[model samples]
Target chain A: MTGDEACAEGALAAGCKFFGGYPITPATEIAEHIAKRLPQVGGVFIQMEDEIAAMASVLGASWAGVKSMTATSGPGFSLMLENIGLGICTETPCVVVNVQRAGPSTGLPTLGAQSDMMQARWGSHGHYEIIALSPSSPQEIFYQTITAFNLSEMYRLPVLIMTDEIIGHMSERVVIPEASEIQLFNRIKPEEKSMPYWPYIPGADGVSPMAVAGEGYRFHITGLTHDEKGYPVMSAEAHVHMVERITEKIKRNISHIIDTEGYYLEDAEIVVVSYGVSSRTSLSAVYEARSMGIKAGLLRLKTVWPFPEAILRTLASRVKGFVTVEINLGQIHLEVQRCVGGNVPTFFVGHAGGTIIPPEHVLSVLKDAF
Target chain B: MSIQSDQSDQQTHPLDDLLRKDRIPHIWCPGCGIGTAFSACLYAIKSSKLDLDHVSMVSGIGCSGRGAGYINLDSFHTTHGRAIPFATGLKLANPDLTVVVFSGDGDLFAIGGNHFIHAARRNMDLTVICVNNLNYGMTGGQVAATTPHLAKTTTTPAGNPETPFNLPLLAYASGATYVARWTILHTRDLTESIGEAIQKKGFSFIEVLAPCPVNYGRRNKLKPLDVLRIYQEKSIIKHFASPSELHLDLEKGITLGKFVDQDKPTWLDMYYKTTRKKS
Candidate 1:
């Protein structure tokens, strides 16, 4: 299966009942696959007018007590930013798959890039936290897509599955697990006897047990800075309390959300940190450098946002220096430097972005960083 | 407008039960006509044969956007100009849901105009209640897509230069199965129109000419009641009027009545039929 095909399958396995998307390159296959399959499973698939409406529809269905998702590339993802903020503010649980293609503005549609890494973190206009995953292969995208939905539901955050054209188009064997093996979860629901349930009021776990429409739990949801009762409350105090709850939920649960894979980090003199397709190249470079008797290791990030600060901080103290490889000019490199906190040098190895950084280039950066 | 009063006083209306009494004394200016439009919607819902639990209200940002927040239903207050698509999702997901998109002129026709035409074009099953106050009311009487030509507005202090949309004509042209126009003064007619639109199968549009006293009225030199009086004297009930005849003429008269009433296959029905036949 291709990465995009695996992503749709993953969503179906995760019990996503609604797929609302606009067709864009590298990401269109995800929508197409789901559109054909959703009807068979008693789910809905709608090709919305535009990406903005697609994003809005996803949030609407999620609030209507169903797991929903949407897929887009750069321009489409850009249009989705406003409603992504809406999803965050309203705490709507859904997945947004940005199968990234090259762009400043349709720069290269049929090619791969990691240009949207920073946008995923801060594209929406507000102070907030986001959860994003990077998949290096078709098989991994399948797993990460499911993980994205699970985390979105668990944290009440809109999780992003960030893949690029190379991975999204690459075909490979993806093992499908039995239905019983997959863990499925809906949002925590308020008990029947809990009359007058304040929908926005989170429990001790900092997640509100949601109630869907037409369930007789007549509740209000808004995109404004709202009070616990979901009423629009415009004040600094309300703003502080509301923003804190959203940001802190992910901050406190960092242990569960962050996923990373380290390749031979023990006693390494130089480390190459990367994610998505770049990680595969970085791993190859690390092996090539090892064959040449260099003490180099590779760190692959599965979860990009919430940046694995503690692990990077610890690795920075031990390693001599770091080399970061990505398709963009420098997106995740900045995060790595921030997490490293100037303990050691962090060298960037990247392309302006229509193609991937080669292993040889990553090797040179690894050698030069030391 | 549903107040949290004693049981005896509340017994006068069924709308009280379908209202969030705590959020009463809403932000609309006193004598603003959104209250009347909202009342008409509630009465329509009450009088309609649809199940109350199966109805959901979706609204976008504006004065009228507060409709979802106050209504005692599964309400969603979405972002600006997006109520139609949001409600579209709800209807498609649960075809059993009677999804209503309630919003304002700027929200429905300007930033969200594409959604309106497209939803109508698809013949999506939705009841769209657009409160047209001739300008962006909550934003302090700025010019909008529905602002009448030569109308006074904050953004158009010298008078609006852009041609405003003829809402009924636009809805009719966009293939809305049922299209109607009404004013707050025509409560009986508006209520009956809303009830009928709610029962219509495919895309239904009801445009309410509301009075935004603080924002729109102050600029146009008309008080809230002046607009109501204008509706009584200057409006002509022209049911089955041609789409071209529904244009607003502040002095001459605005056509008031259902302009289009017809049936067509909805987006979902075609989708299922085509996909099912292929499969």
Candidate 2:
């Protein structure tokens, strides 16, 4: 199956009951598959008029107590930005899949790039933490999408499956485990005995129990800077408390959210960092460079938004230098530079979109880094 | 009449059980009619006799949008211009809930115009009530899609040159199963109409000609009561009026009534039939 199809299958496995999406290149397969399969499972698949409505519908479905998601590419993701912020402020639990294609604006619809890595973090117009996962292949995307949904439900925020067009369109064998083996999470529901629910008050994990519509809580939720009671309170004090709690919830739990795979670094002098489809080539390059006795290692990032800062900071002391490889020109590279903090020199092996960064090019950058 | 019978206590106010009293002294200005429109909605909800637990109200960003937050119902205050689609999701996901979208004209027609037309075209199961104050009330009197052609607004000090949408005609043409128009002066009638809308199947729309006293009224030199009086004097109640004959102009007589009431299969009904056949 293709990565997009695998993603749809993964969502089904994760108990996603609603699929709201627009057909964008590199991501339409996810929608097409869901539109066909969702009905069989008593789920809903709505091809909304546009990506904005798709995203808005997803949030509404989430509030209606259904697990929901939407898939899109660059243009559609741009359109969904405003509502993504709404999801954050209201803390609506849902998933957003961006099968990334090249773009500032329609740069390369049919082709691949990791250009949206930065946008996924800062696309919405506000200060908020985001969870984004990058997958190297169809199999990984399938698993990562399920993981994405789990984290979204646990954190009560939008989680992104940030895969590139190469992986999104590429066909590969994916392992589907029995449904029971795949751990699922439902949003924490308020205790029925607990009346007059304060919907935004954080539990010990800093995630509040959510109330769905028609449950008789008469719960209110809004995108405005709100109080713990979930009513709009436009005061500086309310803004401070609200933003602090949402941001701090993720910040304090970085150990649980950030995921990275290390190829080798115990005795290596150089490391190459990459994500999405670029990580696949980076792994091959690391293996080839090791055969040539270059002592190169691969640090494949699975979670891109949190940026695996602590791990990168620790690795900076061991490795002499780093090569950040991605499709976009120096997006994750800038984060690599920020993490290494000028202790070790960092090199960028990058492309301008519409194509992948070849292994040889990344290998050469690794040599230059050394 | 006894004084005690006439003067009820604050706790005795109707719909108090359905209101968030702590949210009182709402943001609406003294003479703004959004409050009356809001009251009518609650009254209609009560009259409809639907289980309060099975009701959800959704709204976008505007002065009228504030209605959802104050109503003690399962409510969502979503982003600007998004209430209809959001409400669509709610209704579709759980067919048991009575989903309603309450917002202003600018929110429903200007920024969210495509959704309005498409939702109506699909004949989705939802109630959409738009308070048409002829301007963007929350944003302070910017000319709106429903603004009169020669009206003065903060953004149109030179007077609005663009022709406004005739809302009743637009809703009737957009495949709404039930459509009506009224003003705050027609409270009991508006309440009854909303009750009828809630009971109707497919998409139902009500356009309430409301007042934006602080922004629109200050500029036009008309109070909220003045607008209601105008609604009383110049409005003609023409039931099942032709869409072409229902154009509203501030300088001309306003045609008001239930212009469209007919049955049609909704989006979900067709969706289910087709999907089931295919499966």
Candidate 3:
């Protein structure tokens, strides 16, 4: 199966009962596959009028007590930013898949790039934390999408699956476990015995238990800075409290959320850091450098946001230097440099992004870092 | 005749249970008509006799968009101009829930016009109530899509050059199963119409003409009473009137009543019938 189809299958495995989407390149197959499969499982698949409506519908479905998602590329992702912010403020849980293609605007719709990594972190126009995962292949994307949904439900915020055109279109064998074997997480519902539910009071985890529409909860929710009762509060103090709780929830859960895989790091001197498709290239280069006795290793990032900074900071003390390889011009590289805090030099091998970064380029960077 | 009968100490308001009294006093101006129109909507919900536990309301940003926040049900105040699509998702996900999109004219037509027409065309099961005050009331009466030609607004100080949309005609053309128009002064009729629409299936729309006296009326040289007087003197109730003929003309005559009420399969009905057949 292709990565897009695997993404849909993963959503189904995660108990996503609703999908609202509009067609965009590199991501449309996720919608197409789910549209055909949802009906069989008593789920809903709505092709909304546009990307904006698609995102709004997803949020609404989530509040209706259904796990929902949507898929889009650069242009559609831009249209979805406002409502994504709404989801964040209201603390609605859903998934957004951005099968990234090359673009400042319509640059290359059919081609692959890691250019949207920064946008996924800071796209939605606010001071809040988000969870994003990048997968290198079809099998990885399938697993990562399910993980994305679980994190979204656990944190009560939207989670992003940031796969690029290459990963989305590539075909590979995806291992699907039995439904009973796949772990699933659901949003915490308010206790029915609790009369007059206050919908925004955080528990010990800094996540408020959600109350869905109907079931006589009669709770109110809005995109405004709201009180514990979900009533709008326009004061600056209210805004501070609301923003802090949402941001702190993710910040405190960093050890549980950030995922990275280390390769050939035993007594290595040169460390190459990459994610998504670029990580595949970096792995190949690491193998080639080790064959040549260059003592190079790979640090593959599976979860991009929250950036695995602590691990990188620890590695800085042991490694000689770092090489950050990506398809875009030094996005994650800036984070890599910041994490080392100028203790060690960091080199970047990338471009404005139309084609993939070749292994040879990473090998040359690895040789240079040596 | 009976001051004790109206005493707050002796009797509670019938709609108090449905209201969030702590959030009030509301932000509407002294003469603004949203209160009356909103009250009629609340009464309609009461008279519809549907399960209140299964009812939910959604609103976009505007003066009337505050309806969802004020209601004591499962309500959502969503982003500006996206209430219809949001409500569509809610209804589709949980067919048992009765979803209503209550918002203002500018929110329903200008920024949100595409969502409204598409929802109507698809015959999505929803009750959409639009309060048309002829301008963006919450934003200090900027010019709106429903603003009359040659009328004054902050954005249209030189007079509006664009002609207003005949909202009933638009709703009817967009394939709404039930379409109606009423003024805030016709509280009983509006309430009855809303109640009927809520009980009926498919996409139902009710456009309520109301006054934005502080922002719009002052700029247009009409007081709140003047607008009500025009609604009283010039409005004609003609059931099953052609929606195209129903336009707002204060100097001439304004047409009001139920324009279109037909039977059609809602989106969910077709979705189930077709998908079950395929599977």
Candidate 4:
């Protein structure tokens, strides 16, 4: 299956019944495949007016208690930020797939680059925690889509699967797991009904069970600083409680959410940090450096947010230095630097728009680091 | 004596008491038509007899968007200009729930313009109440898509050079099954129109000509009541007016009444029926 077909398959596996999006290069295939496949499976596929409406519709569908998703690229991703924040604030669970192309704005629609890492995290207004995953292969996209949906349902927050253009447009062999083999997570439902349901109320695990509209649960939700009842409460206390609950829900449970893949990091002197398609290149570079007798390894990030900071701190103590590589102008590199806390010297091999860094470029960085 | 009897008859309806009384020293300025429009919504909701629990009121950012928070229903005060799309999702996810979008002209026709047209075109089963105030009152009286040509507003100091949108006409063209327009002053008519729109099965749009006393007042040189009276006098029933003559001019604001209405399969109905047939 192609990467785009894998995403559609992933959505189906994750029980996504609704997809609302407009077509853009690279990401357009995801919409096309889903459009053809969804209706046959009793799902909906709408070609929205623009990326903004696409993102908004997904958010709305999620609140109606259906698993929903939208796919977009650079400009579309930027348009989606405001409503994505609404999803964050409202604790609506949904998935957004950004098949990264080049550009500050429509830079390279058909090309590939992982330039949207930071924007995916902080592009929306105000402060909040987000869950973003990166896929290096078509198979990873299939699995990561399932993970994104599970995390979204678990935390009641929007989860992003940040795929570069290469991976989104790439064709590869992907196994469609039998339904019994794939794990599914449904949003927690209330034990009682007809009583006051606090949509934002955090459980001991920091995630509140979600109740859908028309489920006989009377609920009020607002974009303003709200109380447990979901009504707008203007006060320092209300702000503190609401913000703390949503942010803390994800923060306190970081251990369960954070995921990373390590290669030869057990006794390596230098570690190459990467994610998305760059991770594939980093893997080859690590082998090249190792064959040259340089003690280099790779820390492939699967969960980009709630970033494996603890793992980086542990790696920094053992490794001589960490070299971060991505297709952006040093966004995630800053997070790496902050997490390492100057313990290990950090270096960045970055590009912008739709250009991917060569394996040789990453190998040279590892060679120099050692 | 007949008027008294009519009033008594209206009071006998079940939704007569749901109107918020204390908020009654209403926030809208005196003569502002939003109060009557608000009452019309309340009366419509009351008359539908749908469970308030099954109805969710969603609004975007604007004076009318504030209606979501004020109204006593399962409400969502969402981001600006995205209410219809948001409500579209809400309705599709749970076809059993009644999702209504309440937004101002600026929020619905300008920022939210795409959503409005698409939702109408899709014939999503949702009720959209667009309170067309001519100007962006909440953001300061700026010209909106629905603002009349050469109309004076804060942004259009000399005159609004751009052509104003005819909301009902646009909605009808976009495939809305039920389309209606009413002024705030025509409380009874507006209320009945709203009820009719709600009862319709497919995408329904009611463009209520709400008065903006604070910002639009100084420019239009009319109080809210004046705007209401204009609606009463100018509006002709849809059956009476010719389609070509329906164009309204800002200088001499024209007809206001229910326009296009036809039964069509709603998005949900089509979706479910297709699914069942396949099975």
Model 2, residue A15: distance off in Å is 0.5
- Best of the candidates, lDDT: 3
Q: lDDT by residue for model 1 over A8-38, one digit each (tens)?
A: 9999999998998899998999999999999
The sequence of per-residue lDDT tens digits that candidate 3 reaches over residues B1-279 is: 655665464466799888888887788899899999989989989878889989999999999999999998999999999999889889888999999889999999999999999999999999999999999988888999999999999999999999999998999999999999999998899999999889889999999999999999999999999999999999999999999888688766889999999999999999999889943
Q: How many clashing residue pairs, candidate 2? A: 0
Candidate 1 clashes between residue pairs 3 or more apart in a chain or in different chains: none
lDDT for residue A277 in candidate 2, whole number 0-100: 93
TM-score of each: 0.97, 0.98, 0.98, 0.93
Q: Which stretches of candidate 1 lie over 4 Å from their true place?
A: B1-14
Given candidate 1, what's the lDDT at residue A94?
97
lDDT of each: 0.90, 0.91, 0.92, 0.84
Pitting candidate 1 against candidate 4, the one with the higher DockQ is 1
Clash pairs, candidate 4, are A102-A353, A102-A354, A103-A353
- Looking at model 3, give its docking quality level: high
lDDT of 2 by residue, A11-83 (tens): 9999998998889998999999999999999988988888989999999999999999999999999999999
- Which docking band does candidate 4 fall into? medium
Candidate 1 local lDDT, residue A46: 90
List, residue by residue over B1-279, the lDDT tens digit for candidate 1. Answer: 786767674454568878887888778889899989998999998889778888999999999998998888889999999999888888887788899888998999999999999999999999999998988888778999988888899999999999989998899899999999999999899999999999999999999999999998899899988888889888999999998877577767989999899989999998888777853
lDDT of 4 by residue, B9-76 (tens): 33443433453332335456666677668778987888788887788888998788877766666678
